[model samples]
Target: MITARREAWTGRVLLVLLMAITILPFLSLFVTALHPSGTYPPGLSWPGEPQWGNFLKAFQAARMGELLKSSTLIVLGVVPIALVIATMAGFAIGHLRTAGRNVVFIAFVLGLTLPFEGIITPLYYQVRDMGLLNTRWAIILPLIGLFMPFSVFWMRAHFVNMPAELSESARIDGANTWQLFWRVHVPLAMPAISSLAILLFLWTWNQFLLAIVLVDDPLKRTMSGALGAFQGQWGTDIPLLCAGSLLILAPTLVIFVIFQRRFVTALLQGSLKG
Candidate 1:
């Protein structure tokens, strides 16, 4: 009993230390962001007076309004279409008895192995050839394709674990494949779908490399992607830079906090089901 009690105490202490390590950087960042715009405070020292307006200054300086709009547009474009395609493909593979289904599923699984860095060069050239360079489509199209493998995999895991009797009963009721999918499976898959949407939103919002490389217009890139240019333009202003970073991070943080329960449910469900 004493040994087990000691072990539990040790674990609690270690967890507290780990939490501090994880949180300290962000705490420092928030503190630094509150410092006066032009002053570069050494280390993690708190400012004498917190400059709250630094965020507004940073927002205007970074032209964040346009960047936010662009990121929203990209997310809007990518998430819906990707979800639809992935869901259909997953349903076909998971629930249907189609020929060569294994082959098709393997093709998507193979896609998971192809990293963005591997094909980015070729992709750039292809987009250039198609006259999509420097456009939002350049980012949107590639992101959808890039997200497909994992999205399909995630949805397939959910569908495969769902009771076969669900589809079986629907078929006996004279429902067609489309009806079975839309009327039955889709409604039941809401939790997984909602989770997928949240993830896609986060991924699309945070996407940097493709946004920077594919689009030339700073206004057309994601907020995080545009941060490079923002940093270049205002690197010396440490407080301003930190403020801008916080602004860029705020939306995603807000989203995760709000939808945390759903996200956790999806992860737990997927793990148990898959």
Candidate 2:
């Protein structure tokens, strides 16, 4: 009993330490953000007066409204289409025993090995050739393609691990392939799909490289993408810059907080299946 109590106390202490370590930086950012603009306070130092209006100032100066709209459009354009394609491809690969399915799966696995840096230059030229440069499609199309490897892999893992009895029972009931997929599999896969949607939302929102590189207009780029240009313009204004950074981070933070339970459940399920 003594040993168990001691171990429990140690674990609690460790958890508290970990929480502090994780939270301190964000606390510092919030504190720094509230410092009056043009007054650079030292680390963790509180300003004489906190300027909560700095967020409004940053929002106006950065044209964050337009940036947010662009990000929403890109994310909406990417996530649903990518989810549908990845789910269908995963189902085909995982459930169907068609010839050449292994070859196709291997192709996608190879796609996972190809990094953004390796393809960015060629992608730029291709987009330019297609007259998509400086357009939202420039970012949207590539993001969908780039996201495929991981998304398909994730969905495929879920489908592959699902009990074969489920599929066998559906088949016995005279369900066609379409019915098997839409009626039987999709409903059961909701948790995994929801988890993937949250991940895709995060990735799409936080996407920086493609947004910055593909689109020339900061207003047309994602919030993070525009941050690069915003930084260049306002790097010296520490408080306002921090304020702007927090603004960009807020949506993703809200999303994670809301769906955190689903995310955790999916992760635990994936681990157990693996």
Candidate 3:
């Protein structure tokens, strides 16, 4: 009992430490943002008078409204389509065991190793040739494809772990492939699907590199993409820049907070399924 209590206390301490590590930087950013735009307040020092309006100034200066719309559109464009493709691909590779499924799965596994940066040059030329270089489609199309390796891997993990008996029973009931996938397996896969949705939402939202590189118009780029240009313009203005950064991050933080439970559940579910 004493040893168990000691271990529990140690675990609590570790968790607390990790939470602090995760939270402190954001807290620091929040504090820094409240300072006057041009000033560099000392380490963790509170400003004499907080510049609360800096957020508004940052918002307008960064064209956040437009960025938000672009981000929303891009996210909406990417997430659903990616989820469907990933889910179907995962179901095939992990559960259905269709002909050439192993080969396809192997290709996806190989995609996991292909970093975006490495292929950005080729991708840029390809997008240019297609006349998509300066457009949101450049970012959206690539992300859906780029995200597939991991997304499919995650969904496949969930589906493969589903009991074989369930599929067998559904098949015995004369369910077609579509009905089997839609009715029996999909409901069971909700936790994993919801989790993947949350993940794809986050990734697509904060997709900075591709957005910045592909879309020349900052307003048409994602919030994070705009941040790069925002930084370039106001790099010298520490507080204003921090304020813009925080504003850009607000949606992501809100989404995570709301869906945190689902995300954690999916992670735990995946681990147990494995």
Highest TM-score model number: 3
User: What lDDT tens digits, residue by residue, belong to model 1 across residues 76-174?
Assistant: 999999999999999999888899989999999999999998999999999999999999999999999999999999898888887989889988999
lDDT of each: 0.92, 0.92, 0.91
Off by over 4 Å in 1: 1-11
TM-score for candidate 2, please give it. Answer: 0.95
* TM-score for each candidate, following the candidate numbering: 0.96, 0.95, 0.96
Q: Over the full model, what C-alpha lDDT does candidate 2 score relative to the true structure? A: 0.92
Please provide, for model 3 over 89-152, each residue's C-alpha lDDT reduced to its tens digit, 9 standing for 90 to 100. 8998999968998898889999999998999999998999999987889999999999999999
lDDT of 2 by residue, 1-274 (tens): 9999999999999999999999898898899999999878799998888899999999999998998899999899999999999999999998877789889899999999999989999999999999999999999999999999999999999898888898889999999999999999999888888999999999999999888888999988888999999999999999999999999999999999999999999989999999
Worst 10-residue lDDT window for candidate 1 reads 265-274
**Consecutive 10-residue window with the lowest summed lDDT within model 2:** 93-102
